[model samples]
Each structure stands twice: as C-alpha cells, then as structure tokens.
Target: MIIRKDNLLLLPEVYLIIASIFYWVNTSTLFNPFAIIFIGVLLYQVIIKNKIAGLLISSVFILLNLYMVLALISELSEFTTSNNSFIRLLVFGVLFLGLNLIASIFMFKKHLVK
Candidate 1:
C-alpha cells in the first residue's frame, strides 16, 4: 500500500472532530475552551489560505460556539452574571468571531485583488 502525503494534513482536524464529539458525549466541561481556541486558530489559518478548508473550519467553529453560548446563557439567568469566568468566555467567543471575520475579509480581498 502506498501512502499519500496530502492526506496527512487533515489528520489533526479529523482528530479534533473526534475528540470534540467524545467531549460532547461525556458532557465534559474542560474541552469547550480548548476546543474553541483550537478551532478558532484553525479557522483563521484556513481562512487566510484555503477556501474549502476555511468553510469547513468556520462551520465547526460556529457550531461549537453556539453550543457554548447556549450553555452559558442557560447557566446564567441574567446577562449580568457576577462570574468572571463566564464573562471571559463570552468575551473570547465574541473576539474570536470578530477576528475570524476580519481575517476572512482580508484574505478574500487579497486574493480578489491579486
């Protein structure tokens, strides 16, 4: 059997999807923050380079953030929660979304103008 080097590039993303699914199944709280950051970075990279990869990564990031946002909103009855942790999570999510959008726009413009 011959090995293809191109397939190796997808390994990390595949692994992350699997792990994220497992974390969801286990109702593990620890995975959300890490997963969000990981997916964010991956999305940023893809957005700056590959359209197909960027679409895939961005979709996953949005889905994951939706889950996290719903969880946070549910946990806190009011938006004004005294918990710093929840505030940080919310801030991070918003920032990630903004950064991804900015990166994507720049990438698109760069490619279009070239």
Candidate 2:
C-alpha cells in the first residue's frame, strides 16, 4: 500500500475539529461556523493538491491561533488563579498554534521548494 504525503495535511484539520467540539462543549456555544468553513475549504484544497490555496487557508488558521495565543498570554494572570482552567486554556492555545504553524510550514515548503 502506498501512502500519499498530502494525506498528512488532514492532521491539522482533525485537531482543529476536535478542538472546536471541545470549545463548544466548554462554553455551551451553539456552533462554530469558522471551524466548519475553514476546515472544509482546507480539506478541499489539500485534496486537489493546490499548494497556494492550502497555504492560504493554513495561514488564516495560523493567524487566528496566533491571536488566541497572544490573548491568552496577555490574560495569563486572569486564569492563573484558577489552575485547572488556566492549564486547559494554555494547552489548547499552544497546541492550536503549534499545529497550525506546522501545517503552514509544510504548505510553504511544498509550495516554494518544489
């Protein structure tokens, strides 16, 4: 069986979907439209092997996650008093940032290097 390298791009989407579900559960939000919209677009772009589209989608996610990371850091003290919530937010923010960064870098290399 041969494995396609492009399939690896699904990793970030899966993580984002799971994270969105958790966010909904935690906040009791009705839905997360951004997750649905962005992940769907990213999946399509990846399937079609469109490097530019994939990079752009992943870059958008990266920016969103970066904003979350910065906001979390800025309000660190607000949650620090509550260890459980603070840890949860920190982990979620960092993981989201890291996963998007990885996807963006992968797309960048694929788009620019070869």
Candidate 3:
C-alpha cells in the first residue's frame, strides 16, 4: 500500500503511546516485541542495504534487548531485589528504546523526503 509522508509519523507515535501506557501501568514488556522486530529489520538494512544509520540503531537495539533479557532472566530465576529498582531499570530501558525508535523515524523521514 501507499505510505504517505504525514502518515509515516504514526509509526513512531504508536511506539511512544505503547511505551507511555506500559510505563504508566507499571509494566515493562511492551518494548520487547518491537525491539525483536526492529533488530531483524536493522540487520536486514545493514546486511542487504548497507545502510549506515542501521548500524547505530542496531547497536542501540541490542543494548535495549540485553537490558530486557537480563531483567526477564532475573525475574524468571526468582532473583530477589530489595526494591523495585529492576522495574525502574526496565522502564528506563523501554524509554530509551522508544527514543531510539523515534530517532530512527526522523532518519527515515530525512531519507524519504530527500
């Protein structure tokens, strides 16, 4: 289908909305699915298209994935924490993921507008 330039804003906005809801709801898993898909797409861009922007975003995506995986593993293993610090970390991680996704949106917009 045709993707309008203005409509392109919806991609990042949707990510922002989901992240906001997860943060407000005291949940941290919302970004993981998006991260997984993003990682694959970034890799495709890097390997097939040799896109320079994909390199940086892919690195950021991996870091975000690492944080999520660690948090998940700790929770799954019943690792105890004195406070809800891990939850906070997860929230921050999701925030960064959203920010990076937002940045990628701008980068894409730049190329598309050119």
Candidate 4:
C-alpha cells in the first residue's frame, strides 16, 4: 500500500476532533470559539492551494475568532444565576463543540487531503 502526500493533512483533523470531544465532555470550553477558524485555515490551505488566498482567509479567521472570544466573555459575564444565561452558555458551547467535530471531518477530503 502506498500513502499519499495530501492525506497527511488529515492527521491533524482527526486529532483535533478527538480532542474537541474530550474537551466537551470535560467542560473545558477552550476550543469552542475558534474551532471554525481552524477549519477555515485548513480548508484554504488544502483546497484553495494558494498562499495569498490562504493568508486572506487566515486574516479574516483571526478576526472572527477574536469576535467569538469577545462574545463568549460578554455572554458569560451576564450568566450569574440566571436560566437564560445558562441556556445561552449551553447553546453556544454545544454549537461550537458540534462545529468542531464537523469542521475537522469536513476537511477530510479537501485539498489538504487531496
């Protein structure tokens, strides 16, 4: 059996997906906001196959992750013994967790894995 070069890109995705699930079950919430950003970067690197395009996407990706961080903090601050806050936290948390899983898998066959 021969291993292809592009398949190497998938190595990180699998690891990321597993780690994200672990973080979810353990309530880490660290990777919640930026998972999509990672996916975006990987997708561009693998599929776009253009350094310039990847750089542009990465710039936007960083800004978006920053936005997510700010939003998470803002929402968390209002979560003081309130049902609404708890629900928002759960919603955002689970949404990102799921996104992390999908993002990793979605990059599986992209240019990164070509």
Candidate 5:
C-alpha cells in the first residue's frame, strides 16, 4: 500500500469528523451546522491540497478547539476534588481536545509553509 502526504493529512480531519459524530450523538442536536459545513470544506481542502483553504480551516479548527479546552478547564476546576463520571468525561474531553488543537496547529503550519 502507498501512503501519501495527503492521506496522512487526513488523520486530523477524520478525528474531527468522528468527534463531531460523537458530539451529535451525545447532544442529540444539529445546532452546529456551520461546523459540519466547515468540516466538509476542510476535507475538500485536504484532498486537493489547497494551501490557503487548508490554512483557513485549520485556523478555525484550532480556535474552536482552544475555546472548548478553556471552557472544559473552567468546568473541570469546579469539580477538581470530585470523583464522578462527569469529571472523568470532562478530563477526557480536555485531553482529546488538546491533542486535536495541537494537530490542527501542526496542520496549519504545514499549509503555511507550503
């Protein structure tokens, strides 16, 4: 099998798509159509290796993840001493969101350099 750069770049997009699916499942809401649309555009950018569009989408991804991380951090702090399922969920959210944020930043850098 051949693994190209574009294929490798699909990793973050796939992760975000899966995360969005989980978000929709858990929340039972389609209130964030903008994100869904952006993700579709981001996938297109990755497939075509469009540097400008990729950078723009990656910037939006990074900002959204950062905002989520900060919001989770604020919520987590309120239950720092608790040992509950919700706390565990928040911790995992923060961890995965941080990873997502880092991946987005790296993706953005790659687009910028190209």
Candidate 6:
C-alpha cells in the first residue's frame, strides 16, 4: 500500500527530534549543520510530492533553520576568543550543504525513474 502523506511526513520530523535530543544531551553546539539538510528534505517532500502536510512542515523547517543559523553565527562571534568553533561551524555548514545537494539530486533521479 502507498504510504499516506501524514506518515511520510513524520519520518523527517522524527529524525530531527532525535537529533535535537542528542544535541541537548551532549551539550555540543545545539545547531549542528545536519539540521539544515533535514529542512531541505522536508521541503522537497512537501514541494515535490505535493503533500499538503509539507506546507506546514516546510514553514517550520525554514523558520527553525533560520533561527539556528543566526544563533550559531552569533555564538561563533561570542566564542571568538578561539577560531576553532568558527572553523568547525564553517566546515559543518559546507558539509551540510553538500549533503543536501546530493540528496536533492538523488531525489530528483528517483522521481525521474518513476
């Protein structure tokens, strides 16, 4: 049976929730870059798959990622006593963007296959 949009949408949210829990427990920079890709994935699901649920999910993803990025940059500025945090953030940001692009490409390929 085809999966319902409601159920499909939950998958990425669940991933984000788990990541959030891990971040909280570790106390290691709350907004690690993977979260942005999660937002992009959710957006792809909503936009490409035409799921109505994606509208709300995409909005949340956009807002959350924006806040996270801003907060991360602000914290990096405060932590400027050492450049390590800034470097790490830059590396992770690039990695996240790369991963998001790759995932988007794969998703597009899958769409073409079907």
Question: Which model is ahead, 1 or 5, in terms of TM-score?
Answer: 5
Between prediction 1 and prediction 3, the one with superior TM-score is 1
Candidate 1, 1-114: lDDT as tens digits? 876754554444444554445555556675577656665665455345565655555465556656666765676555565688777767765665444444444434433444
Residues forming the 10-long window of minimal summed lDDT in candidate 5: 18-27
TM-score of each: 0.36, 0.65, 0.32, 0.42, 0.78, 0.42
- Compared with the true structure, the alpha-carbon lDDT of candidate 3 equals 0.54
- Once superposed on the true structure, which residue ranges of model 4 sit more than 4 Å away at CA? 1-3, 10-46, 82-114
* lDDT of each residue in 11-95, candidate 3, tens digit only: 5434534544554456456456654555455445534544355445545544664676677566645637635776776676566
lDDT of 2 by residue, 55-112 (tens): 6766776777678777878877675386877888778777766775676665556665
Better of 2 and 4 by lDDT: 2
Tens digits of per-residue lDDT for model 5, 8-47: 7677767777666666566667676865675677668656
lDDT of 4 at 65: 46
TM-score-superior candidate, 1 or 6: 6
Query: Candidate 6, TM-score vs. the true structure?
Result: 0.42
lDDT of 4 by residue, 49-92 (tens): 66454445435544554566677668777766768758778687
The runs of at least 3 residues in candidate 3 whose Cα sits more than 4 Å from the true structure, single-residue gaps closed, are 1-83
Q: Relative to the unseen true structure, what is the C-alpha lDDT of residue 12 in candidate 4, on a scale of 0 to 100?
A: 44
